[model samples]
Target: MMSQAAVRQPINVMIVEDDNVTRKYLAAAIQSEPALQLVASFDSVQPALAWLVSTPVDLLLTDLGLPDGSGVDVIRACVGRWPDCGILVITMSSDEDSVLACIEAGAAGYVLKDAGHLDIVRALMDLHSGGSPISPLIARKVLGRMRDAMPASSAPASNADARSLLTRREAAILNLIARGDSYGEVARTLSVSVGTVQTHVKNIYGKLSVHSRGEAVFEAQRRGLLRMATLKAREPG
Candidate 1:
């Protein structure tokens, strides 16, 4: 007998946007996606948080500005209640405070409203599939922010020496990643296979003792291991 193909379950998704038009557009886009299922959509944090308390969702696309509270609260709720669930920010707020707060709260993706419906769907899908899909421009800004947050004090000589544990190729890959290149983009730039990029990234993350891209960037900066590209941004224009 021929083996039956394993069925794939649609990802459960939720939305929390106060704007009627934007919410409808995002909801329709997600609903129409074959791999996504609209578990629940809310206009405020209260209802969304309530729903999350009882229901398990795979992904959450939330706006930073809610009728009741900032969506960071919702992100915190999801991170706290459902650690496995992926969280995404679908808001116009791209400022350092907003982005850093969401990332620190365990959001896996950040999408601005200007990215439009298709990009939003792509980001949701990417985040749900163990990927962190931050826009390149936003990623650049985030890297700059991470570099700027450095303390006035210098790292211990030993700390800097410890960063030398990264291989030359791994260091190069980390710099490209901090510059906002995706795995595919990194592979293209280096003229290597996508799996090669993944391997390098995994090695870099392990060497740096970080679990996410944001953490990798921050840890690089902390250890004085960030490349000249990121280090130069700290210079005044």
Candidate 2:
């Protein structure tokens, strides 16, 4: 296992924004960051999706309003081709539906296009570090939606209710993933194969009604299915 103090590699990043100015700004910001390397920049969804087939990037920054198609498609393509890649959406849209759709499609972060270059770069860094950096407005909207989805009269779910949603092993896997462990890291920690971790991930996603790690974590937390303290207590030192 790599020590926490080990030097980290530069994060390879891809950009998919239709607006020329925004795309260039994003590219420049990424290029300026010493820890990040700009791999590919695209002005549309199709080209971005096409390029993803051959090149695997560590992070993807995309805008939702593309001339050819929605950025959600690009997010989905990246998620399918590179499950470990971090996806961040930079867009003007902050509607609940758009935010939920992007989250459901596998985006880990969502920032408004109006963010400064430094802010954008910081968001990318956060996403790469397994933090979901979302615009305040977008975050509020998402939280409001989640709250509305739950029954107003319902009390906090019991541990038994949480356990029923996932097997013990599945919960352990989900806990690790929610804390940002990649499949390989989770496999090594659990003494299982990467393929086995992936199969568990698929089952977790299906049972949680989510398509990505971020969404799975969000849904599980909302459903009161995750006990972070308990999970951490069980982690091997």
Candidate 3:
């Protein structure tokens, strides 16, 4: 096995941003980063999702809003097909709902498009390295939403407690989520792929009978599990 500190080769990255200027900027940013190799950049989720199935991509930086379909489809495809490939979001929508949807769909990092080239490059690097890179404002928004909805999710569980439903790994992942760590961050911390992290999270959600991260956190807290913060990465109803 490779050492933890060992550096891997340049990550083969794919971009799926829709804007022309943003796409050019993303391509340039990837080209400039020594650790990143641009494999392909597309304007929609359809072609990108199609490309991801057959390609061995190391990283994927996609936008949430595309002309054809939302970027969530792209994230789901990558997570389901190329579990090893790390995924990041670069979008104008920083709403808690949108962020949660991307997270539930299996994105590792969520960064806004307003970020500069260096910021984007850094976020991608962090994500590729197993870190959850989210914008500051977006992070705060998530926290606020969880806090606001805490009352409703505070109800107690029966003999089949929420905590007992999840495995040890799932519990650890929930703790990381409570601490505001992204899927990629949890994966890196556990030395697993982003997809694996999402799988564990999905199992956790299933066991707790929760849909969103915030609901999970609230449910865990109600059942006297790991109590810290809240989040939920699922599509809005």
Candidate 4:
């Protein structure tokens, strides 16, 4: 059993969900936990990112779809800024592509929106303990992708053209976006402010010479960077 002292430090959390009702529900659920604190909440990626620059939190929970951008962007930004922080993608998307994208963007967990409060609580606890909590269906898809990629006799090497255009981090973020997370989620996963994520994205755009999310994703794919399933399979345990 955990000691009293261990339980005293509340786990700070930020919530980013576009839906007002769902966001309120999530906030209430998180607030109910004695060990968790809802530090901030936002309905869009831009404002959330703006807040993160000044306020730091231990966990970030977000949805894939937002008014401004994808939640993958948030995850990348978070991971970039606060690599130690935990990120959870709490969304309705169960598509393999979206699930794989969240993981690639550095989310520590993926809980389906339909999951009950208990399931979300379990995911939070798991994340706190350094576990990667993914829904069963997501896990199976990731495993299948891994198995499929393992037999490649000789995978194509990253081309110099692509390598020269994007920095390692930018490339990674692009890959995550292609998979479908929001910018606020990316920021939390990366541990950086939303502005920083935006900067990297802007840099990615400038370097790749592309504008807009779809264009960036397509370009990254053409350059062999949108391999979400492959990347997730290779992530360290």
Candidate 5:
């Protein structure tokens, strides 16, 4: 008897976009990928919320703007009912408040509508793999907000000791990541393999006691570990 090839399961994806053309485009793009399955799609908030009541999904891709109401409600619902499901926001909104609201409402990833279809797909994949995918521009804004939110009191002297835990290479990798470079892009910039970049990131996460990229960045910023100079925006490739 011949051994059988292992079959991989497709990720179940749900989409909620009020625009008909955009909805179809998103659905088609998702369907084009063999690793993703279009489980359900909604044009507004209510239907998406109603569908979530009985159905379970691996990922929820939603727009912030809806004809009836905000998509944040749907994100919150998924977080409440299906806590394990990863939520990704795809929207045209790049304002600080909108980005912060989605992040506060339990969204794992946020990408602008201007991102290529492949970029959106890659973001979903990253979310599936325990990564938080945030667009470069949105990332800068988030970091800026974090910097501004810092208390007037200086950080403890112990923060420097804690910062020293990261190796030079690890710090370099973290800097690149904070600038919104993907693992692959970081690898290319550092002339290393993607796996190597991921390993360093994993170590950075451990040292920072964070589970995701956003948390790592936030914690690093809080500890005064990041070089603000390196955080200047770079044009996303």
Candidate 6:
């Protein structure tokens, strides 16, 4: 096994936002951190996807609404390509559907656009440190949803089986993929290759006995491996 010292490395981040102003601001924030390297910034999903195919990164900070497509697509591509990469959805949308959909697709963190730069920085650090972070408001919404989903008669079982079946990293990647992150985004966030991400995904699928993303997500939900609200609460801000 690799030593802890050997495993430690600087994080590479990518920002995908349609607004030039926002993109620049995010890039600047990422650059402010000594431990984080700003790899690239893009205005649309297509170029970001293309860049991801050729380059490697550690994290993806994206807006849900993009010029060409939804930020969710960017997440999907990243998770498909980079399974170890961390995915954080930074968007203006606070609608429950948008939040739930992103979580179901595999986002590790979700923050509203209103969140300050410090919050975003803290969130990125939290995610890098293996913590799932969500905005406070988002967390409340997620908690409410979880409460609503729970059966009144019985408490939900902790997904010890599923948790034991996969490493924390694998679970994180799977969760993001379930939320909507792309292979490329996953690769970048995890600082691994796309092929590596695919390998992990394949392993996850085999272990879960699921074929498609939908099936994997359903299984994850059934196994109690993913609690939509719990993940949100784990976020930094």
Q: What is the C-alpha RMSD of each candidate to the true structure, in Å?
A: 3.6, 8.6, 7.3, 12.0, 2.7, 9.2
The better candidate by lDDT, 1 or 5, is 5
How does each model score on lDDT?
Answer: 0.77, 0.78, 0.75, 0.70, 0.84, 0.74
Q: How does residue 94 of candidate 3 score in lDDT? A: 78
- By TM-score, the better pick of 2 and 3 is 2
lDDT of 6 at 94: 80
**Model 6 C-alpha lDDT per residue in residues 1-237, reported as the tens digit of each score:** 899767777799999998888788888888888788898889998999999887877899989988898988888888888878888888888887887787667677777787554456767886765445565566555555665676754444555555788878788887776554556667798999867877787788888996444446556765667657544644554
Ranking by TM-score: 5, 1, 2, 3, 6, 4
Model 1, span 1-237: residue lDDT tens: 544434677789998999999899988999778889998989999999899898999998889988898999999999899899988887887797888898899887776777443466667765664456665556767766765776657656646586778887888778776765566667787899877877777787788787677777777877777675653453334
- Steric clashes per prediction: 0, 0, 7, 35, 0, 40
lDDT-based ranking, best first?
A: 5, 2, 1, 3, 6, 4
Q: Where in model 6 is the C-alpha error above 4 Å?
A: 1-8, 154-237
Q: How high a TM-score does candidate 1 get?
A: 0.82
Which residue runs of candidate 4 sit more than 4 Å off their true CA positions?
1-3, 115-118, 152-237
> Which 10-residue window of candidate 5 scores lowest in summed lDDT?
1-10
lDDT of 5: 0.84
Across residues 1-237, which tens digit of lDDT does each residue of candidate 2 receive? 887547677799999988888788888888888989998999998889889998999999998988988999999999999999999988888788888899888888777775444367777876776556665445445554675687755526454576697988899988776654556667899999877888888899898787666687668767766655644453334
Q: Candidate 3 at residue 43, lDDT?
A: 96
Pairs in clash, predicted candidate 5: none
Q: Following a full C-alpha superposition, what root-mean-square deviation does model 6 have from the true structure?
A: 9.2
- Model 1 has an lDDT value of 0.77
Give the CA lDDT, 0 to 100, for residue 64 in model 2: 92
Winner of 1 and 4 under TM-score: 1
* Reference-based TM-score of each model: 0.82, 0.66, 0.64, 0.60, 0.87, 0.63
TM-score for candidate 2, please give it: 0.66
Return the TM-score for candidate 4, rounded to 2 decimals. Answer: 0.60
Q: For residue 114, what is the lDDT in candidate 5?
A: 81
